[model samples]
Target: MDLNQIRNDFPTLQEEVNGKRLAYFDSGASALKPRVVMDRLAQFYEKEYSNVHRGVHYLSQVSTLAFEDVRGKVQTFLNAAREDEIIFTAGTTESINLIAYSYVLPYLGKSDAILISEMEHHSNIVPWQLIAKMNGMDIKVVPVLDNGALDMQAFDNLLTPDVKFVSITHVSNTLGTVNPVKEIIEKAHANGSKVLVDGAQAAPHMTVDMQELGCDFYVFSAHKVFGPTGVGVLYGKFEVLDQVKPWQGGGDMIETVSFEGTTFNVLPHRLEAGTPNIAGVIGFGEALDYLAKIDVNWRYQHELNLLDYAMKGLKEFPQVRVLGTVPGKAAVICFVIDGVHAHDVGSLMDMNGVSVRVGHHCTEPLMKRFKVPATARASISFYNNKEDIDQWLSVFPKIFKFFG
Candidate 1:
């Protein structure tokens, strides 16, 4: 990918912040939207703004086609089996919640357990907690090593026959460690468990295929992948989704309603209730289309080169300890400056027009394991370059001196 040409696509990258050009290192939080996505959203609202599936009006027909087309786009994006295997929700949190309640809750019992890892975000962890609380099912945790990789030995030991489901984060949002998901899925399947991968981080950085991974279910959020917020995806096998009941009941999700009883809709629509995010879904399609134009591996290598620069530069300062150094790791780098609050570091970086994330990064258990309360993170993205990394790295000396 041409980094210079691609960089020009983002309007936010041109803005000045605090007397300096903006160096956005916070793509892990949410990616900056490109102009094409903005134009698509405006076109939808300006011309074809109407509710979907319920109206026979001309505007509604146009809007419904555009909205449903996104479902196909996502199916192709993830290489899911069929278009109906894709379900839309608010975000990654809701996607996992839908699986927890609809597919998982009903299958759990006192003798059954759900397996997760120490490095999971709150979204992946808390939903299983709710199911465990509701039923008597147990929540088993796979440990993370000192280097921030999942302990495969511990994971192997934890995968007992009682584990009815396994949900794991595909990549550590904080550590950027890419787990061996294919092996994990196979191991879980060997134990008669269905696997759900939290691909919110992996899908954005690298190409993902749900079929080849052999995962029964996979999910990610749109905003993380340069699409609009308020939309996320849940990809389940046809057989798996066939077994799951609807999580919500409302207008479009129902096939028939009576005073006696009500029947739910089919495949994805059953899980997706009420009027969906029409404009946001349309924007998501455009974002995916824009993404398809770029070579994924090229972008990944460029980001990795940026990551190497940051890692080597951080090694120069003895006070700054970077976290999660592993081969085949993604661009996110979490680290801490000794004796300095992460928030202070983040605030100082912001003053230089350098954006970064601070704190436990929604993975408090991982933080507790690492024996730190919080850390400052400079997460790189495809739109970011070495200059952006240098902008943040140059401020580190000032941070250290100020803290001292």
Candidate 2:
């Protein structure tokens, strides 16, 4: 891959911050958008803007075709079996909530339970908790090992017959631990439970095939994948998703409306209610096309090299305590300086124009597991290089000097 060309695609990366070159290290929160995606969004708004599936005008038909085509692109991207199985939501959080309310709450009884890991984001945990509270269902947690890997033995123990559904993150947003989701899916299916994989982190870094993984449901946000925010994709196995009732009622999701009776639409439209994020979805398609041009192996190796370089540099600081040391983990490092708060470290980094995330990162449970209140996370994207790492690390000595 041409590294310079790839970096050039992101206009924000070229700009300066506080008189220093911007070194973005917070990709785990949201990826920097490529110029192609930004231009596509502006183009759609200027030329092709219209409400899809409603009007008979020329712009409406053009917009409808463009919107539906994105659905097909997502289907091919995830290797889903059918095009109608893809549903667009606000983001991964909304997708999980849809499943929790529309599928799980109705299907599972009081005696049933759901299994999730301790490393899950609040988005994955809170929805199930809401449903479980209303229905008296149980929520079981799989522990995280000290090395930031899931405890497979505990997971096995937790995967009981009573566990009717399993929700797990493909990659931990905090620890950057890539879980054994395929194996977990196989085990869950063997125990007669359906599984949902939160692919928000995994989708941006690596390729995901729903058929190969054999997951019942998979979800990821567009912003995390270099697309626009306020748009996300939820891929469900057709057989499983067809059984779910619509969670919200509105214009597009309905087949017919009357005072006495109403009927819902089929597959995708049944789930997508009201006017959707038309411009965001179109830009998301452009982002996917942008990624398709690059060789996956090259991108993967590039980020791995960056991760290794950053880790080696962090090792030089005795006061630095890095969390999630799992081998073969993704390109994220969550660490804490012994004598400094994470917020202070992050603020100091910002003065040097090096952006990083500092906090629980929506995984308070994982933070407590590591015995820290918060951490500074440097999540690497393929766009990043050794120079970004060097600039990020340069702030640590300033942090020490200021704190001491």
Q: Can you give the TM-score per candidate against the true fold?
A: 0.99, 0.99
Error of 2 at 378 (Å): 0.4
For candidate 1, the lDDT comes to 0.91
List candidate 2 segments past 4 Å from native. Answer: none
Q: CA lDDT of each candidate? A: 0.91, 0.94
Instruction: In angstroms, give how far residue 73 of model 2 lies from its true place.
Output: 0.9
Best by lDDT: 2
- Model 2 weakest lDDT span, ten residues long: 292-301
Model 1: lowest-lDDT 10 consecutive positions: 320-329
